[model samples]
Target: MTRKILHVDMDAFYASVEQRDNPDYKGRPVIVGGPPDSRGVVCAASYEARKFGVRSAMPCSQAARLCPSGIFVTPRFEAYRKVSSRIREIFLEYTDLVEMLSLDEAFLDVTENKKNIPYASQVAKEIREKIFEETRLTASAGVSINKFLAKVATDQNKPDGMTIVRPDQVEKFIESLDVGVFPGIGKVTLKKMHALGIRNGKDLKDKSLEMLDQSFGKSGRWFYAVCRGLDDRPVEPYRERKSLGAESTFPKDLENSEEILRELADIAEELERRLLKKPFPGKTITLKVKFSDFTQKTRSLTEDYTYIDKNELYRIGSKLLGEFLLGSGKSVFPIRLLGLSLSHPESSSKITTVNTEEEDDLFPSLF
Candidate 1:
């Protein structure tokens, strides 16, 4: 049986929420994240901001430079999470096969939904309407036979839009797609593909399997299948999160070890709050550092038992940061980002014991 996959993404989630809560922000360029004076990145940019070449993940400072008049606002994650929960409730009304990707996006497998909806597109339409009716926010949806096509289609007509790719249209759709737009093809990979004259799906299809394998290894093989619209990856509704983490980029890179430790304390506090909200017993604590030069590294330590003690997390995090600084020999002074994550809890083992096939049958392409 052909599967019915729907990818739903909120349009400018954080920015839109800000605008919705504050009528004065409506129709104006809103940027959410760290302040422009700090070394932070843009978390979300409104459509109006995007027109000024502002984008998520771009440096907040750069975004400010791009749109001098843009209103910069800090993210209200709690509010966003509340909306996300509400949206998930709506998804559950139709199917238990909903796989949340993040606070702003999810993929639903409605092939055997609770509502017994016959048309995937109709399910998507109703879901969007329900989301708007409850939250007063816009969502874009893509409906197709598999996750790949559904995800790509979601972006075709965005911000309160829906696009459907019927099974019959899959082949032609794949053939005409630009190679750069295919999932997992980054700038570096795109450059390599261009050198090999693989500019589009047709070009990718023309390459021999052996040649592609020699050029790109396992990813090449995966690309070969995806370019032909043959993605069988299941939507795994039961995929357990292996780790929970939070990170922050500073307004200014930290040059002093004391300053770094202070920042780590604040981050640890935030992590504790998160753990309290979604309590997890993780034994391993990992610290992430991104230096000013764009180089990144991680250090971790494991305990005998899982715990979520704030002081312990902070102690471990600070120790990790101290060790990194001491090892640096005063060289790598400025650090752009710092992060903390908890993992390797006892519950994770139990996650794998669930019936994989059953989960797959109910949900597709969760990861």
Candidate 2:
């Protein structure tokens, strides 16, 4: 049976939410994330801001320079989370086979939908409409026979658009697509593909599987299949989360032990709040540090049991920090970023205890 997939992406999610809540922000450029003067990056840029070439993951400083009149807003995760929950609720009304890619996007397999919708495109339309009717925010959707094509269709016409690729049209759609537009094809990989004269799906499809594997390894196999519109991956609703963590990048690097410890205390406090909200019982604590030169190191210690207290998290984080200092001979100091995570959960049974939080446990930043 052919699987009918729909990918729904909230347009400029953070910035859009800010605009929806603030009447003054309407029709104006809004940037959400860190302050422009800080070492923060753009989490989301409004359509108005995107006209100035501001984009998510770009430095906030650069975003400010690109659109000097843009309004910079700190991320209010709680508000975004509420909106995300509502969006997920709308998705569930259509199909239980919903795979949330992030707080702002999800993939739904509506082949056997709760609504018993005949066409996936009509389901996409209704979902988008219901989302806007409930939240006053817009979403773009892509409907196709598989996840890859659906995701690609979502981006073809973004920020309040819908694109559908029928089974018969999938071949032409894949053949004409630029390789860079495919997921996981980053700049470095694009350059490699360019070196091999693989500019689009047509070029990619010309390569033999053996040649692709020899060039790009496992991802080569993925490209080979996706180029032919043969993605067989299902929309998994119950994906396992491997870790839960948070990190902060400072405006300036910290040099002394006192400053480092102080920063870790703040991070531990943040992690504690997250754990309390979505209690994941894990036996491991990992500390990650990145230097001003971009070099990074991670230290992890897994205990026999899970950490349930805030003080314990701080203690373990401090211990890891000390170990990193001693092990690196203080060479990794003047750190620009610090992060902490808890992993190796006690069991899948423990996951059921986590309430209100999404399934994915990587970090807060989806992009």
TM-score of each: 0.69, 0.70
Candidate 1 lDDT over 1-367, as tens digits, reads: 9999999999999999999999999999999978988766677899999999997656688999999999999988899999999999999999998888778888899999898889999999999999999999999999999999998889889889999999999988888888887754644457668888989889999988888765654456777788788888788777676777666555457877777877777667556645543446677777777676656666677777675555677888877776557654442558866777788744322211121111111111111
lDDT tens digits, residues 154-217, model 2? Answer: 9999989999999999989999999888865644457668888999999999999988865664
Error of 2 at 85 (Å): 0.7
Clashes of each: 8, 0
RMSD of 2: 10.2
Stretches off by above 4 angstroms in model 2 are 243-367
* Model 1 RMSD, rounded to 1 decimal: 10.4
Model 1 global lDDT (CA atoms, 0 to 1) = 0.77
